[model samples]
Target: MISQSAGKIFLAEERGHNELNWFRSFNTFNFGSFYNEHKHPFESLYILNEDTLAGNRKISMLAENDSCIVLIPVVGAISFKDSAGNSGLLQAGQAQVLNVYAGTTLEISNPYEEESVNFLQIWIKTPDLQSTVPQLFEFDLDKNPNQLLELFSPQKKTLVKTVPQPHGVIGKFSGRSEAVYNPAQSGNALFAYVIEGNVEVQYRLMNPRDGLGLWDLEEMELEALSENAIVLILEIPVLKTV
Candidate 1:
């Protein structure tokens, strides 16, 4: 049985950095400053790191073809050139997802040439996909039409679904509507993690990084105004086999 802490935050850190093996790297945890702490992973715990790179610097001989890698820019534009001679630039409003299985090399640099670039890189076990070419999908905060981003199960086209069916849904909320979530099924477990700002959720005060877990509830309410509250929501099936 998964512990109640399963939906809890095991780690949380602000923007920070350090150097390793002659390579300067940024990470969410100060522990990364020590080389030995750089390697750690669990069955469900994949790779999670927020990184920033200086101009013309190279770290981690990352291949373009690695099971599954996603790069999301939070600040400056990140310049990238892959093994297949593929090149592109990712900015704050963009995210690049690659499935590197056919052999691909990647070289990322500061897009500004003089300034640095920062982004979040998460590596999860790719679902059983026989053939998945690197796919790039640009997301603009304005594209939501209502300023909302939709992430569903990669297994399903809509509704948040994880590759492993993830057992839950995870996302952020940053608006007035609160992204009404209603699970049509029972035994669904859900929770929300505040990333930044505050929100008057269900009349309760939620500050940055604060999280609340909920289960056995079919519907929950969220509303925010005055401040753009950023929240990470996770929904899971309490009992199911995938």
Candidate 2:
């Protein structure tokens, strides 16, 4: 059984870090060689990695079957090409969702000449795919400051038939601004990550790169402690199996 505590905070410094010649990754959960018995998968959300790729360098990974991968560029744009014949450049203001099959090689590269690129890679266990195409969503958090901007939601009719879909949103808020988030479904878990600046979630203070997981709650509260605070929220359903 999962913990029924009010919440669990994963501190930024506690994340597992991996450094390579061309890549540096910080894993929020067990991934690659970064495994922690306490840092287990949060419900259906399996992987949350903050990765930095060196300029002109690339890395490839095999996609997992029956899963969804989400990419969000943080510091710079990233160019990606997959064996499935899908390719694109994902900018900072956009999010990409890919419905991948097993054995598909996905290569992500930094397009800049001398600057490194930072991005987030999230993996969620999903239902079998009905379509293999990728989807891109563009959002301007600066234009709609202090409000949550939806990035990807499985509830969309256009989404491939992946049941029990996770909902993702990003928001930029001003200092002292407060917001309330209601889960789309009861029993769903909420994972909040502070992308920049300070914030308080459910009364727990969080710094940049910190993550908080809350479950068995109908609503969660957030308050930005600094100007231009950016946050990412994921409402994930708890699956029967890991």
Point to the candidate with the largest TM-score.
Answer: 2
Cα-based lDDT at residue 166, candidate 2? 76
Per-residue lDDT for 132-215 in model 1, tens only? 445565555434432335332232342343323222223344466465666544555655545556654444566654545565
The 0-to-1 C-alpha lDDT of every candidate, in the order given, reads 0.50, 0.86
What is the Å distance of residue 200 in model 1 from its true position? 8.6
Clashes counted in candidate 2 amount to 0
The Cα error of candidate 1 at residue 141, in Å, is 1.7
Taking all chains together, each candidate's TM-score versus the true structure is 0.60, 0.91
The whole-model C-alpha lDDT of candidate 1 against the native structure comes to 0.50
**Residue 100 in model 2: shift from native, Å?**
1.2
